[model samples]
Target: EDLWVEIQANTFKNWVNEHLRESGMQVTDFHDDFCDGTYLCALVEGLQKRPLKPSWNKRPANQHHYLENATTALNAIEADGVKLVNIGNVDIVNGNVKLIL
Candidate 1:
């Protein structure tokens, strides 16, 4: 179970990196304050369940809006025939990571 969690986390990290690259965004440390494994996992899971469709015409200006835009953009690319492995629940209990893939 422990090993599986690590594998899933790494896979999620790689997925994020790939999307960031495709979107022409700089790759940042996943452990950085801006984002982390748990957050990425959650975001990807949300995306898988219901992909975001952002209005490109009404460009967002704030940080919160920017994040939403980014998510939408990534989802758009994925919608272009890129099949991403579905990621489900990502929970941390008693300092142990639990992942559903």
Candidate 2:
């Protein structure tokens, strides 16, 4: 489905380019595909270069969530001064996530 949407966007872009030629304007091809929906085509906001405010920027719950997580992390350090100090490989076993420490 994501691929389909991107294909649609490309098709729409081509159609617009052809129309531009009719107006005596030369265009050297263009691609307009954004499956992330961060962009919109002619009728959509993306094609017009209109930016969407990130969802996280609007949701109060998400803001609270990060705040809570930060506080928890601080508390962990305060209690034990222990923390994961490295980015290491993660493995899954028996449907459980195990991290290499």
Candidate 3:
């Protein structure tokens, strides 16, 4: 069960990375947060609900901007495909410093 959970988490993380790359958004550092299988599940489900958008900012001042833009894109993803799933209490703090899931 543990290995299966890990596999699922890794797959979800890879999907997130791929989506962020395709959208020209930098993947936010979730730090140790990735160790929590439930958190990864939540992140994946949240992202699926709203896919990341491509960056439109021509002159982002910093990496923070990229993350912000990516977040905006994620929130803007259309709600047509997979049905949205709800995971509890996932928070990104300090403007990408840490993710508490």
lDDT of each: 0.42, 0.30, 0.41
Task: Summing lDDT over every window of 10 consecutive residues in candidate 1, give the lowest-scoring window.
Answer: 87-96
Angstrom error of the Cα, residue 5, model 3: value is: 1.5
Q: Which ten residues in a row have the lowest lDDT in candidate 3?
A: 92-101
- Tens digits of per-residue lDDT for model 2, 1-101: 65765576457557655544433433232221111111112112222233222221112244344333333333333344555443211111111111211
Tens digit per residue, CA lDDT, model 1, 1-101: 76976677678667766654533443333334122233443354344554345443233445454355444544554776765454211221112233222
Local distance difference test, candidate 3: 0.41
In model 2, what lDDT does residue 24 have? 44
Best by lDDT: 1
Reference-based TM-score of each model = 0.31, 0.23, 0.33
Q: Candidate 1, after superposition: displacement of residue 19 in Å?
A: 1.0
Please report the TM-score between candidate 3 and the true structure: 0.33
Candidate 3: misplaced stretches above 4 Å? 22-82, 91-101
Model 1: colliding residue pairs? none
Q: Give model 1's TM-score versus the native structure.
A: 0.31
Model 2: weakest 10-residue lDDT segment is: 92-101
